[model samples]
Target: MSSPGDLPDAEVVPKKRWRIPWIWVVPAVAVLIGIWLAVQTVLEKGPTVTISFKTGEGLEAGKTKIKFKDVEIGIVKSVVLSKDYTRVVATAELTRDTANMLVDDTRFWVVRPRVAGGSVSGIGTLLSGAYIGMDIGRGKDARRDYTGLETPPVFASDVPGRQFVLRAADLGSVDVGTPIYFRRLQVGQVTAFELDKDGSGVTLHVFINSPYDRYVNADSRFWQASGLDVTLSTDGLKVNTQSLVSMLIGGLAFETPAASLSWAQAPANTTFTLFQTRSEALRVHEHIVETYVFNFTGSVRGLAVGAPVEFRGIPIGEVAAINTRFDPVTRQISIPVEVKLYPERFTSRFESGPKKGRLTNDPKALANFLVANGLRAQLRTGSLLTGQLYVALEFFPDAKKASIDWSRTPPEMPTTPSGLASLQDSINRIMTRIDKLPIEQLTASAQQTLDNTSALMQNLNTQVVPQATNTLAAARAALEAAHSTLLPGSGLQQDTTEAIRELTRTAASFRSLADYLQEHPEALLRGKPEDKK
Candidate 1:
């Protein structure tokens, strides 16, 4: 009964309060949704981050993110020192797509102003303050660990270079950081140096451009340069240079092509040895020692250990050792010299000569043979300029022993003569003999001889020569007159001139004949025997 009326009442009660406008509520909801969405995007994607550095040296995190390039891929979160205080590690966050760039061998370094010596480098970077320099080396192998390179590097693999080692007499004052140069051009440097354990050798380590490795080899000579310039004058040469700076701060130089060396693969560690160039002072031949401890007490002013030692008149070998010793029996200073002689080896070199097959291996036979041949040791001059002397073997014409004298034969082989010492002794003996001479008596004898010669000359000139000269002049005049008539040019002046003219005419004729004969050589063989004419 009230259905129509109830519908009307319910409608009227709902229209009583329209709580809020639909338009305002809808826009407000939309604004909230948009803000929430923006915040979520920021949390997931992050902002263009910035990493602060003590010196923001090599970082381009914002502008140059870790993407291919210009792609907003990743950013450096922060730059901070490691916890242990060793290094400055940069934390970087990669975008979803940029994560692939963090592979092995991917190194990062800070690029700043570098100054070595007075030469300054990277000065252009002063304006940019500093930057994060990257060295990208792709490793075929994958890596998850993030690591860094030991040092920021210059691109060196493509440079023209090689590796080599130098054996120096001394490292001199060379240090590890020394440069290696070629003709003053910077080519390489010294990486390290080590001393030999025996305290004998120093190993110098050096490297050159790789292409130049072929030039280093076995015969290469090395010398240390101490940056000292040397010049010569009348007082000899003077040098002004610093070896220590050369070792620590200066460099070394070498040459190739002009002086090439033999090449071989050196050890991983390169090393060279130095030797003293004193070969002339050391004997390297053959001889024999009669006794282990023998003394040669003699003057040896110019004698050297390596001086040649001779036996009789033949060069047996050389003096191996000369040393001082106090003999237990004699209790005196014994200057002992050791000699070496290789009879077999010597004979091999000279056996083909006139004395072929005569050299014997038997020591006694050789000794007897030598003594019988007037063999004696003598001093000989080697070089007057150097005052170097050598022992010589001489054969005296009036030697006592004509043949093998077995009666007084030496039980042991006689030592070969050392020329230097022998010469010194000879000079000493001559000086002694001269000193012992009676000067007054010798002077008186010389004066008497001079007086006698003068008297003989006076007698020949004054007493006998005048009359003899007059008689000889008369005889010579007659002889010359007779000879003049016989010879062509010895006659009167006119006759002499005529004769000379005739001779000249004859010579001209002969020369003409010779010329004709030369032109027709067969005419000589066919000519009539001179006088058929």
Candidate 2:
């Protein structure tokens, strides 16, 4: 090598190209893969959400999944206690596709084993561990932070149905999740209940599923079917039950009356009244009620509030109240019964009659006429077995005339004693008449007669009986003497036998003589000549 000079000449040749070491090639490839992975991780990432729960039970960071309709859509990244420590907060990462599903009304709850509302649910979580369940909301606003539910909803939002509201005097046995029945078939459930703000009643929210919702109409009557409805009336014992479940856990039943079946379907969230019984639900609504009071003189022990008030045998009203009033001056106690009468009930029957408008137009005149004609209210036994009494209006021709007191707040009607009371009064009168008689004197007279009879019997037993006995002995002696005289073996019998034989001989001689005389006399008489001996 001619040294530097030669090297300079060789410098014109291209310097050896820079070549990377094989070890570095491996590092380069690794760096490129790491960059690509970072970019992919960034691209696939989605929005983060925070969910607050009562507890951290069944949740695991990086392992717990967030699912909707059983499809995994997100995962829990971390879990920590809330600031106040009242709950646990979970941070979750959801795919980008689920970003729109986060809504104001979105629901989240843990899927775990739970028993409620007469049902067992979330059984699959026992094997798969618990997961966060999500229900998409119909809300318009979007949200990320959420409050999880302690329990799953009874119905999914997607379920096709309608809701309604019911007002009741009391909650009775009804509770959330109680079944609602249509003709004994379960068609819906109670979703919620709240006490009225005024504390006078309860408000219930119910949901009817799909096709069953169509059956609910504006005229539908709802009643509590929680227990057995047993009625003891003139028709006899009636026991009604909707179902075994209803009897045990309680339920609701609704039906449109046969006459109102053509009514329009009730819209969603329609309000309705919940009645206590089917009868009450189906009873004709009477808007025009007239209040009347009756002062009864007899005991009203069997008469109670709500007792039927009848015109003849038909019910036209009911007893609203029963009150006892004591007249201090007279020292007498009377029962004042308040009754609610539906005049329409009677008017409807005579709608086509001439008296229809007359009665409605001038009720006071009709009342006066009825009273003048002896219309009286009386307490009558409705059920002898139950000892239940009801009010009855009847025409009593013999009753004393009475008039209604129109000046009273509730007009006062005249009343008569019940049949039982009348009988009691008659018995009392008879007892009074008997009491007025001289009972002591009558008893004394009867005792005196008895004493005389006893004395007479004693005298007969002593004197008369002895004399009679002596006379009977004498008679018996006479009979013995006669019997002895009639004996055939005695001396008299022998003498009699001898006389009879002598008489026989004499008789034969006379016969011979008579025959001779008869032959001699036959010549003169021509009668005994035929006897030629």
Candidate 3:
């Protein structure tokens, strides 16, 4: 404080100010932020998984992304050869959200552009390149490794439907992803199909979506609906499924009979038989309680197992089989046809008592019933165009008497000859009767009678002509004499008048002589005649 020149004069040394350097502090904070970012980057990096594939086609490390539900979820970090150098192992880094999808049962497959089984898929991949698709399959566990599938599965785990199995003789025009129809409406699809274990046929696994699945019942029938089924029936050609889609890709359809209520909804994984046609399904069960064997001596070419068995113009059953063997009775190459009769089909609901019990159920009663009614089986033509033969049952009052023995194993029925055979028999009988006639003998007798008549006519012409001529000449001479006598001025007329006058005179003298002779005879006889004279 002493400063006055040193004296107490205020020493004004410019005030030293306390100012902060903001530039240096800002730099320190920036350096700390840089350190923090590096640590977080290391901590947030997700875990990786390894997948094995047959080939590394359409894959590139760090370039190809793995997706789920069409959303990008991971990237292929690396692709390398297996230790055996025979396969590829692809390592992928997934997002944190995919943690739950990492399960033991998870599935993975690459999505690529391709066509298979009549369907085109993975079209989006054409523009964006190929990708890995993942599905969290049927489990709740976690996994870090998997073996990817070469092809996509028929259905996703999340699809809602019921699966069933069907057995068919041959998979004609059927393929995976084929549409299944119900009343001409698409309702389901075929999932997987494989040849049967025993090589007998093929087995198909199909799925029907909800709502539509309810339509399937135990009694439902399924048949192929592909191509054109042209049936030349009596009515006309019956064509089926002419649609281009069906003809190309093929399809299947089902029908729930009117008696669907006989059973409940079909259970999952239910097994069924796939028929080739609708008619085949109808002829499935003969349900024949009464079996009768008919021996057909005629042609059985068109007769088959499904041939109709009719009774009095009503359908009663079908032909169970047509077999050739030595019959027990005929002991010849008789075509013993097994026809099954379904009595319930013919018995009306109005019948009751012993008659109500179907004859098919009781062979003994049926035999008696048939005998009393004089029922016999005969073969008839069902379709003239198809040449299909069928069995016909009818009653003939005076039919050749026959009987049925129900005690036999299969119960035999009285059989009459086929319609064609009966006609042939009648024709042979007529020919036999005509052959027995004496045609040659009759011709010879007729010829002899004509010769005799000709000879008689010749004799009359030669003998009678001369005698008749002589008689006519004699009669002509007599006529000439009579004509001359009858002439008015002829000599015969004058002589007749003179003769009459002489006769009158002679008659007068005879009268007088007679009177005198009478008197003289009286006088001579009795003297008294003299006086009278």
Better candidate number, 1 or 3, judged by TM-score:
3
Candidate 2 residue lDDT tens string, 240-343? 88999999888999988887787888999999999998877887777678899999988898787878999989998999999988999999999999999888
Report how far off residue 84 is in candidate 2 (Å): 3.5
The segments of candidate 3 whose C-alpha lies over 4 angstroms from its true place after superposition are: 1-56, 78-89, 144-147, 232-237, 261-263, 282-290, 327-331, 347-361, 405-409, 436-533
Off by over 4 Å in 1: 1-155, 158-160, 164-170, 175-187, 192-204, 217-250, 253-324, 329-424, 430-533
Local distance difference test, each candidate: 0.54, 0.90, 0.81
RMSD of model 2, in Å? 7.1
Model 1, C-alpha of 89: deviation from truth (Å): 6.0
lDDT of 3 by residue, 32-79 (tens): 998888877666666689999999998999888999889899999999
Which candidate wins on lDDT? 2
Per-model TM-score on C-alpha atoms:
0.40, 0.79, 0.69
Candidates by lDDT, descending order: 2, 3, 1
